[model samples]
Target: MINFESQNLICRFRGIVLQSILWNNDVKSTKYTIKEMIAHHSCLELPEGKSITKADTLEDLAQLYELDDYYWAVKNIHPLTHDLNYVL
Candidate 1:
């Protein structure tokens, strides 16, 4: 079990490193726009919740924005924006 966990961690780390390298290359090449990056990150489906309804109120709007920001920060390669050191 420990071996499996270690392997998973290593794989995930490699993926992150690869993603960072790709992002760096994109930044250098100017091939990827910030909007495209944001859109890519926002493609994830939110969890089932009443706050996600179309008829949601202003409070829901705030919550939704917060959720999007949190999701982007977590999925982003930058360490400063991430709340935790490790990926979820």
Candidate 2:
């Protein structure tokens, strides 16, 4: 299970910076290690504008674009194969 304790998630992935729009950093720590963080949210979002949560993976992230919770996030994603509604 995720720790749920508060944390500061900073993304410096491959030297690319990620500034979370919603201040996701200060929220609860879903995972404990930098490796874990990279494998999920910060790293992916910085480069691809896509991130995963405890309930999702990179593949799962694709499906999220169709959901209201993640639809807005697709605004910054270019070269998308689908339309605004994502239709994934």
Give, for candidate 2, the lowest lDDT window spanning 10 residues: 14-23
Q: Residue-wise lDDT of candidate 2 within 61-81, one digit each (tens)?
A: 323333333434644554255
Best candidate (score: TM-score): 1
Q: Candidate 1: count the clashes.
A: 0
Candidate 1 least-lDDT 10 residues: 26-35
Per-residue lDDT for 3 in model 1? 75
Q: Model 2: runs farther than 4 Å from truth?
A: 1-6, 10-59, 62-68, 72-88
The total of clashing pairs for model 2 equals 0
TM-score of 2: 0.17
Angstrom error at residue 11, model 1? 0.1
* Model 2 / residue 15 / CA error / Å: 15
